[model samples]
Target: MKDRAVLYTFESVHQAIKGEDVLRAAGIACEMIPVPREISLSCGQGLRLAAADAEKSEAAWRQAAVSWQKKVHACRVDGRYRYGVEN
Candidate 1:
């Protein structure tokens, strides 16, 4: 199996939920994932998006004018992990 993930953080939980809604409306598959411990040990909500859809997801967020802070990291779960471009 192969999987990709992206983390999108917001200043507040409200913004995070709102952003999720916008992305869902745009037909982008996303889920609320725990903020990676490496990025921030603090417990907060973030978004997990498929790596294959990363580009389209970012584009949708921009088009929706959703205020968010995002970090795009690509990793291969089945094989060796790696980081990719940040959008």
Candidate 2:
């Protein structure tokens, strides 16, 4: 949804997949999407998450099956996803 605030950028697609698995198992609502060009063209995928669950998501990611680059608190400003490092 447009209100969702953060996108967790993984180091790699594999890591993003692992993150998806972990969040699913932990009951966090999220998905693996192509890493938006706005975030980073270098990465292939990212995990979109609800802004409200950010704190819990952080814990979930810590227990993820793999690692991520770090999460970004993304806000769609002027129709673009503007972001900042969340760690």
Highest TM-score model number: 2
Indicate the residue-level lDDT of 67 in model 2.
68
Which parts of model 2 are misplaced by more than 4 Å? 76-87
Measured with C-alpha atoms, the lDDT of residue 81 in candidate 1 is 39
> In model 1, where do residues sit more than 4 Å from their true spots?
76-87
Model 1, range 1-87, lDDT digits (tens) per residue?
A: 555666677666777788799888888888887676666666777887777777787787778776677575756656743445342
lDDT of 2: 0.76
- lDDT of each residue in 1-87, candidate 2, tens digit only: 456477878777888888888888889898677876766878588888878887787787776546678567876656766677342
- Model 2: weakest 10-residue lDDT segment is 78-87
